[model samples]
Target: MTMSFSPQVLLSKVARERCIANIKELPKFALNDEGSKKTYASVLVPLCVVKEEVCLLYTLRSSNLKNHSGQVSFPGGKIDEGETEIDAVLRETHEEIGFNARDVEIWEKMPIIQGRNKEMIIHPIVGVLNNMNVDNLVRSVDEVEDIFTVPMKELCNIENHGHLKLQREKIILPVYTFGKYTIWGITGMITHLFLQCFLPESLYTNDFMRKKYTIGELMPSKI
Candidate 1:
């Protein structure tokens, strides 16, 4: 029962249905804006699901690396000069994860994520690995320290994890405590957005509603 839907189709459907849902009163966004200010184009978050369940693929970046070192991230990098959003995402995925782009079935891209006036538009691309198993992946030693998969159900489940008010922000975010790593910041924001998009309306419960959805959901795309 592996569920598959065009990314565009799912995003459109979610927007139409949840357009009126009030923003969660969270202070995380304000903190993110104030703490670090950098504009980057296009981020690729890989959504891998198999056997009727969805899982998120993450990488622990090498600690010695510059920028977001030792943080949990998807297989993505900055958009190159003159590169399309899709090109950057696909290219970065190949370079970081060592996976052939041909094996990934990109379903839809989440709306363009805008920050405070930098013209660096971020896009969330959703794709499934042809076979959603660890056996199919090859993590790059240079960029990725380790590659791991967390079941989408665990992420969607409130009992599995909890949120925190970081930097005294009013908002609470889903912080997946994987070992000693806490997935936060933009990656956390993006993860929250996707859960809201894919979880069925009935299945969405308390914590689902408590967490503030990404502002990216409201941001308009150039297309």
Candidate 2:
């Protein structure tokens, strides 16, 4: 597929800006009457590599896992003892996805996003892969069931995604669903917020404003 920006260039811009509004927006989730009162620190990366265009990589957690099992998510995990959030995020990416820390060029970081329970703080890191090929990639079988990628254009285009409310006080965020998976939750919210903050405001044209999504379209694999 044709691409509008060089993966390196776009990531460079995002890294330099390090937009954090979404992270700041986390308190909104906390204040809402959702579930818990605990707070934990975690880091995740929107890992992208340039193919014909930039592609965001994701993983399906093994169904037997404890938290968020079988869900589509970015490569990441909880922060380790004495580790900074960025260091933790980079470290987790390598551990979970087998992405060489050196191969990724960080574009920017979104703000810390809080969990529904207000017990977890999630730092979103955006970066570009230094190389492209399966050989350079890795996945932990215990944590990841499968790894796959989707085009960057599909993500940046607002028309292909939408939001659904889970309850009066809760809403299921929008995400780019490809084939059998739907990118949702904090990852989906981060993706949605990224387009609003980092991409040029002009891309917010009518076409970008009108798209809506459905569960069938978002999770083709579920059916």
Give the top-scoring candidate (lDDT): 2
Model 1 TM-score is 0.68
lDDT of 1: 0.61
> How many residue pairs clash (N, CA or C atoms closer than 3 angstroms) in each of the candidate models, in the order given?
6, 12
The per-residue C-alpha lDDT of model 2 at residue 117 equals: 52
The CA lDDT of each predicted structure is 0.61, 0.64
What ranges in model 1 sit over 4 Å off?
A: 1-39, 50-52, 114-121, 166-171, 179-181, 206-223
Cα displacement (angstroms), candidate 2, residue 129, comes to 2.4
Writing each residue's lDDT as its tens digit, candidate 2 over 44-84 gives: 55645645566677778877688878788888788777887
Find the 10 residues in a row with the least total lDDT in model 2.
200-209
What is the TM-score of each predicted model, taking all chains together? 0.68, 0.76
64-92, model 1: which lDDT tens digit per residue?
67765777777887787888777888888
Residue runs of model 2 more than 4 Å from their true location after superposition: 1-3, 12-39, 157-159, 170-172, 204-223
